[model samples]
Target: MDRGAWLFWVLIASLCGASAFFAAGAEGQRRDVRAASVTLESGAVVSLAEVVDGDTLLVATEAGEKVPVRLLGVKAFDTKLEKDVTKTYGQAAVDKLRVELEGKPIRVLLHSTPKDKHGRTIATLFVEEHDVGLDLVKSGLALVYTVYPFPTMQIYLTAQELARADRRGLWSNPAAVLRADALSAEWRRQAP
Candidate 1:
C-alpha cells in the first residue's frame, strides 16, 4: 500500500480504539451511579461474618466489601458490650440467629433509605430461601420495630405478636422485656 493509504488506516484504527475505551469508562460510571441510587434490584451473595445482635450483621460480599446490614422492621435483644453485665435473652437471641444464618449465604434487598445513622445498610435479608426478619419475629427472638414502613412490616408485626402471646423465648420471662426496655435491666435480676 502507498504511505498515504497506510497512514489513513492507522488513524482510523486509533479512533476506533479511543472510542472503545470511552465507551467502557462510561459504562463503569453508569454502574457506580446506579449503585448509589435508592432501591437497587441487583442481588448479592454474602457470607455472614458476624451477627451484630439479632437484627444486624457484618457480611463479606463476593465483591470483597465488608458491609454492615441492619435487619428491616425488627429489633432483637441487645448483646452486651461490657464483660461486667449481660442483657436478658441477648445471648439466646444471638445463638438462635447464628444457628439460622451464620456462615450461610444471604440475599439482601436494599431499601430506598439505604444506610442508617450508624452507617449500616438498612435492608431486608433472606436466608435459607426465607425472610430472615420474619423468621426472627415468628420465633419470638425479635420484635417488630415499625420505625419505617415497608411492604412486609405488617406481616412481621403480626407474627411477633403471636409469639408474644404464646410466651415464647424473651416473651416467656415474667419481666417480659419489650423492645424499648430490653436493654434496661440485667438478665439475672429480671424475672424468668
Candidate 2:
C-alpha cells in the first residue's frame, strides 16, 4: 500500500483502540455498586473463596479481587469473635455454608448500602435460585437479622420462628437457644 494509505489506516485503528479503552473504563466506573457488576435486581456472579460462617464469606471477582461479603438479614452463631453469648454451633453453621457456597459461583444481590459497619459487602447471596440467608434460616443454622429495611425480613422472621418452634438445629440445643435469646435482646438494644 502507498505511505498515505497506510498512515490513514493506522490513525483510524488508533482512534478505535482509544475509544474502546475509554468505553471499558467508563463501564467499570459507572455502576459504583459493588465490584464485578453486582446490580441490585440481577447481581454479579462471583466465586466463593471460603464461607467465613453462615452469615459471612470471602468471594472473588473474575479479576480475583477478594471481597468480604456478609449475608443480608442473617445472624449465625458466633465464630471467632467476642460475643455476649457462647458460640454453641459455629462450626455447624460454617460447614453448612461452606458446603453450599465455597469454591462455587454465587450471585450477590445488593440490598442496602454496599458495605456494613465492618466494611464487608452487605448483600443477599444466592446459589442458583436458592437464597443463602433463607436456606440457612430454614435449616435453623441462622436467624433473621431483625434490623428494619432488610429485604425479605418477613420471610426470614417466619422461617426462623418455625425453626425455633420445631426445635431444629441450634434451637434443639438448649444452651444455644438461651444464648440466641440473649444475643437477640442485646441486638435490639444496640439497634437504631
Candidate 3:
C-alpha cells in the first residue's frame, strides 16, 4: 500500500470513536509530521544503492528506509524492453548512472509536486549541487520529459540540444537506426 493510503487508514483507525477534540489533535500531529519531513528533505543526504535507470534510483535514508526517487526533468530508455537498440542505450544509461550515483552521498531536492501517483518521490538529485538529470541529458543518456512543468526544463532542453549537436551517446546512432526527425516529433507530442 502507498504511504498516504496507509497513513489515511491509520488516522481513521486512531480517530474512530474519538471526541472531536481528539480528532483535531490528530490533525495537528499530521501537520507537524509534514513540517518535519520538509526539514529532513532540505539538507538530508542519502546513501545510494541501486540505479533503476538513468532517471531513478534507490536510496537508503538515515532512518534505514529505502526510498525510490524518480529523478526530475529527464526520461531514460528502459532496459526491460525487448528491442536490442533500446536495451543497448538503456544499459549504457544505467551503467553510467550507477557509476556516478551508486555508493555516493547525495542530496534530494523535492519539487513542488513531490510524489508521483505510485508514491515515489519526484525529486532532483544533486552531487554538490550538480543535477544528475542535467548530466544525463548532457551526455545524451536521457530525453527531456516535458509532459509536465519543471523548474529546470530549459536547462535540460539545452543539454539535449548540445548532446544532439555533438552526436553523443544515444545521438551517436546512425540516422538509419535512430531517426532524429521521428524522435523530435514524438517528443513534441509529449509536450504540454
Candidate 4:
C-alpha cells in the first residue's frame, strides 16, 4: 500500500479508538449518577414509611417509592410464632424498633452488595450518629446474626453476650430465649 493509504487507515483507527474510549467514559458517568440516586450512601437521610418487623422496615425514597430495608448483622425473633412467649418477645422487638423509627428520619449506610435475595436493601441505620442495629442487640431486642458478614459483627456479638448475661428484653425469659435461639438456627440453615 502507498504511504497516503496507510496513513489514512491509521487515522481512521485512531478516531474509532477515541470514540470507543469516550463512549465508555460516558457510560461509566451515567452509571455513577444512577447509583448516586438509588443507593442510600452513608449519611443519606431516609423517612421510615413502615416497620414491617423487628428486623425489616419500609423506607420512602426520594422518587416516592417504598423500599424494604433489612437491618444488617442482626436478627429478631419471628413475630408470627404460635407460641405465646415467642410471639410476645417478637412483638416487643417490633414495638421497640417501631418506637425508635416513628416520625424520625434516619441515616442509612448501605453495603456494597446492597440488596438481599428478597430484594430488600441490606443496610445499617443511624439516628443521631448512634448505630441502631447495635443498640437493638444491646437492648436484647435482636440477636447478632453472623450468617452474612458485616464490619461490626464482633461488636454486635459482644453486645448480644452482654444482653443475654444481663437478662434484658427477650433474654429475660429462658423459654423465650430457647425459642428465639431455635428459630435463629433454623433461619441460618435456610440462608442461601
Candidate 2's residue-wise lDDT over 1-192, tens digit each?
A: 999999999999999999999999888565333443432233788888767676888787777766778888888877776653336466678888888886677987986477776667888888978998898888788877776457588888899999999998888988788877887787777768
TM-score of model 4 vs. true structure: 0.72
Across residues 1-192, which tens digit of lDDT does each residue of candidate 4 receive?
Answer: 999999999999999999999999999677544533455555678888888898988777666556678899888878896857767766887888888877787889987778777667899998778888898899888888877767888888888889999999889999878976886787678656
Q: Which TM-score value belongs to model 2?
A: 0.72
Regions of candidate 1 where Cα sits further than 4 Å from its true position: 1-42, 81-86, 177-192
Query: lDDT rank, highest first?
Result: 4, 2, 3, 1
- For TM-score, candidate 2 versus 3, the one ahead is 3
Candidate 1, residue 134: lDDT? 87
Off by over 4 Å in 2: 1-42, 81-88
Question: Which 10 consecutive residues of model 1 have the lowest summed lDDT?
Answer: 183-192
Give each model's whole-structure lDDT.
0.72, 0.78, 0.76, 0.81
lDDT of 3 by residue, 1-192 (tens): 999999999899778847677889999677534533432275579878678776777777887666778888787777887855756776787898888876778988888887777456788888867788898888877888877778889888888888989988888887412744466568778777
Q: What clash pairs does model 4 have? A: none
Estimate TM-scores for all models: 0.67, 0.72, 0.72, 0.72
Return the number of clashes found in candidate 1.
Answer: 0
lDDT of 1 at 147: 54
Q: Which ranking of candidates, highest TM-score first? A: 4, 3, 2, 1
Error of 2 at 158 (Å): 0.3
